[model samples]
Target: MSVQGTPDELVEILRETVVSLVRRDGPDLSARQLGVFLTVYLGEGPHTVRGLAEALNIGKPAITRALDRLEEFKLARRKINPADRRSVHVQRTTRGAALLREISVTMAEAANPQRTAGTPTGSQQGLKP
Candidate 1:
């Protein structure tokens, strides 16, 4: 059978799935905390707090607070940028990679809720959905 919900509804489901995954395994991270970690995890270059704030459209202070939590969990680290001592870049640690992979698998399972039945309803184009 074709999926019943609008694409947006499906997207919301995926978002909720991600949120739940983060909440469950990443006990130290809030949804926002996971979001910041993911940003750096996926970025080509190091991600600065300012860049994360800009990317997420959140205030710097909010990003800082999230970063603090991630650092506490050992999933992320604040490193001094070599080119700029005063600047800090966030990097995902081995622990963070493991967490990301775990969350990714959980999200994949969530989005493809019908996996066991042989039908998958993953039509959304991007990762956030």
Candidate 2:
């Protein structure tokens, strides 16, 4: 489904979602690491470090660093490409999928906080006067 909102509203949604992520107990991914993780999980793959760097318009070393962080969290993994042993393929893990689901829920709630149980009303949140 398509979600439409004013620019301010969109930014508020992003802010709220990020705040929720920050307050959560799991790994706190940097912007680059999160971008790389999303790209791998959301995009169709055969994803290699080279391909990610190209897709993201980032350097290979930066991509490698992001992948390293992801691997440390067990959110993604690299496997040697059998046909080309020199290449490494990025793969998603169950933990990564679960994290994505959590993010989706957070975004949804942020987008409609009034509908969420125990969420303060606009006036209470100081969004309305």
78 Cα displacement, candidate 2 (Å):
0.3
Q: Report clash pairs, candidate 2.
A: none
Tell me the lDDT of model 2 at 87: 97
Query: Local distance difference test, per candidate?
Result: 0.76, 0.90
Worst 10 residues of 1 by lDDT: 120-129
Distance (Å) between predicted and true CA of 73, model 2?
0.5
TM-score of each: 0.72, 0.87
Per-residue lDDT over 34-67 for candidate 1, one digit per residue giving the tens place of the 0 to 100 score: 7888788987667888889999999999999998
Q: Which residue ranges in model 1 land beyond 4 Å of their true spot?
A: 1-9, 12-28, 116-129
lDDT of 2 by residue, 68-121 (tens): 999999999999999999999999999999999999998888788576559764
Model 1 gets an lDDT of 0.76
